[model samples]
Target: MKRFTCQSCGQLLHFEDARCDQCKAPLGYMPEHAILSALAPQGGGLWRPVRGCGNTALRTFCSNHAYDVCNWLVPPTEEHSDFCFACQFNRVIPNLNIPGNMERWRKLEIAKHRLFYTILRLKLPIKNRRQDPQEGLVFDFLDDSPDGAAPIMTGHSNGVITIATKEADDAYRERMRVEMGEYYRTLLGHFRHEIGHYYWNVLIRDGGRLEKFRAIFGDDRMDYQAALQRHYARLPQNNWREYYVSLYAMSHPWEDFAETWAHYFHIVSTLETALSYDMTIGPIVDGQATLTHKSDPYLLMPFDDIIAAWLPLTYAVNSLNRSMGLADFYPFVITDGVRTKLRFIHDTVREVQQAAS
Candidate 1:
């Protein structure tokens, strides 16, 4: 997530901002060019980039913009679609007529859009449900039963990711995290983990990398239900951290991959944010200092460099949180075995980039 500035008044902007606060200039994001620009009126409810990046096409915000859930643009060139590339994958949005559903859906979109930002930055392959009904990425934001019958479960199947609307509520989410014994949990983490399952289907199972993946993560052919049963039946304390990223990750090979993949996103994306702010965690105690790297985590940094920077950043941030009487910002430890798995994810993402080229 790079820092954005308003072209109209040079005010700092965030990716989700739809209008610049300083100059009141409308803002729109162009995913193809990976830019968030201030918008200028072009008549007939269309807008053009005020920054002038050689693109003259008039555009409109995604249809979702009307709902205040999306800030991405739809250029005139993509006349076939009314939604932005990210929103096109949504199969079912929450029932807006229901009270509080709108706010929940907004939270979901924020996380989902952030997930797409990283996916696009990584150059990962993603197709809409229309393009590949059997295995393309799609999202379903569902609420609990209206009659209070059953709750919506958050998980991924094939390529459709379902997120329970209640997860958007911070209190409910924290309760679930504690009940599940999870050290860390967030909306972005959910998206990263679920999308990891989607990518595993596309890049490993369909891309002929299953054999290599198995060598690292283990055989995914084991009965998943039984493995999950065993995991919940007893919390393994013997050497679990030595291998898996989390206890749930130890349940199945597929989950191990997803947890590791999620951590990879957590590390790299957070590192990019740190680098963007020129942050360095140099505690000038005796004779040691940390330095910020100029390299971009998405394109330039290798797995080792990412880990090097991420470790210090996590340590500093965790300490800061502790100082404020809050829980650790990053609670999990990255072991050597986990590092190996994360490197595999890093390499696999680079492979996707190469394959696309």
Candidate 2:
């Protein structure tokens, strides 16, 4: 994601900032324009962008803004809907009666919004449940049962993405990561990985690209439960890194696709963040340039360019983290096989966009 600034005072603003810290100005994200803007009231509860001179469309903050969860704008035309593009997809939210549920929900929304930022940046198509109930995208932020019922597992089924609200708790999430022996795990990773499943259903299964998908990801028709049970019961295949991005990815072909897909988003999103900061990699010992500054990764940079920028950025970030005595920012390597899968995801996304257009 790119860094944003307050239009009123030019204060650097975070993606989730609802107000400018320096200028104390109200802020909202203009998804239509893909910008964060200072808001100037237009009377009668309407607002206009302070920066976009030509943008006079009357708008209001998303209803979720009441809970201080969403920073997106909702035009008057969409006011009747009472939700923003992101919140409209939520099928369920945590029961607020429980203490601290709101905070957990807030954390979940932050990650979810970042996920949407990348999807929108890619100009990928999305269908809400209202638009296509059968296959439309939806989200469920659920908590464990009150009576000690089974815990909610973060996964996707059909078009619905369910996240265990506990994952928002830093301690719980870190515990899970250590328990599972994962190199990395986070709320954003969960969103990216699950959404990968959603896209597989849409762009590949429904878009007439299943055969090609199978060719690249292998047969997803393998019994999912059996594969999962086997994965947990047995040790990960030897030299798993030679073929998979993570151990969990080896559970099934579908998982392999999702893992690779998530990393594709990770690579592109971080590269965009780097571009926002005008970052460049290095001049090697031989004085040969490597990963020079470039255009937006979403629209301008090609597959090879993204990898070139991403690899160096990962190395630099890892080194920086080591300097601080922290774990590597990115622990996995993108082997030749992983790159092949990532390319497939990138091409598939572009192909879907072309078809939609």
Candidate 3:
């Protein structure tokens, strides 16, 4: 996500905020430019844009600001946007009164918003299933009742995506990561990766992209049921580090696509962030700084140049994390085989944009 500065005090601000840290000014998302902006103060924590802005001029703040969780706004005139874009996608939010459901739902929504940041940045088409009722996006955030009435599983299907609330808990997520022998995992990773699966299904559901896809990820027509069954029955491949992001990602063609798609976003966004900070890159080249916030401004950089910058950036990040007593943030390697797969993903996303345009 692009870094934001408080319009009220010049201090940096996070995207989700109701007030500024420096000046205590009211904060609102400027949908006009898609960055969060601080508004000049009015009386009693009430706020208004500096003037001549569209979203403020229309009036759009979260209905739930009184209770917390959402800081998004929608104009009164935009009946559709009355709900924040993310809230509009919800088909099922776990019963808030249920033990830990509200906390779980909040975590999921936060990750979903981060995921949306990338989607919007990429300019990918985002149609919610709830909004369209036919072909738009929607989410099913659920937790099986302790009683056995509904199916307990949650996953993306067709245009709708389902995420179990358990996935939101770090302990639960870590437990699954250990059980599944995954080297890296996170709630945001799950959302981004699963959305990749949804988008891939949308982008290549027809036969045209199938043949090339086969050469890269094997084949979509392969039996996912059997493949998943086999993967669970056996040990994760030892050499997977050379070829896949994690063991779970190696489970099937679709999972592989989603995992790779998630990583593509990870790499692109991190690189852009590095460029924006203007820090020196890594050691191999001898002079470039890794803390930089300025790389290729528009990501129009050739594939090789992007990769060139990332290698050192990852190393620097890993070292910094180690210094802080945390595991490396990115725990996978992009070998030749992985690079080839990534190129396909990069090409696919570019094609997706081109076709949409």
Order of quality (lDDT)? 1, 2, 3
Best by lDDT: 1
- Across 1-357, the per-residue lDDT of candidate 2 in tens digits comes to 888988788899888998898989988887766788898988976788885534767798888998988999986567776788888899999899989999999999999999999999898888999889887999999989888778799999988999999999999999999999899999999999999999988788887888988887789899999999999999876788988899999999999999999998998898888888877785475776565658888876788878877888889899999999999999998889888899999888777667767
TM-score of model 3 vs. true structure = 0.88
CA lDDT of each candidate? 0.89, 0.87, 0.73
TM-score preference between candidates 2 and 3, better one: 2
Error of 1 at 293 (Å): 3.0
Clashing residue pairs in candidate 1 are: none
Evaluate model 1: give its lDDT.
Answer: 0.89
Model 2: which ten-residue window has the lowest total lDDT? 282-291
Candidate that beats the other on lDDT, 1 or 2, i.e. the better one: 1
lDDT (10s digit) by residue, model 3, range 1-357: 667777656788777777888889777765435767666545644456754344555445655555466666554455445466657777887778887777887788778777776776676767777546665678888777777588556577777788888888899889988886677878888888879877786666642687787788887787889999998888776687687776777789898888888888888877777676654475433554434334452236566666777887888789999999999978889998788888887777777666767
Candidate 3 runs further than 4 Å off: 40-47, 51-56, 64-66, 75-80, 130-135, 148-151, 280-283, 286-299
What is the total number of backbone clashes in candidate 3? 24
Candidate 1's TM-score: 0.96
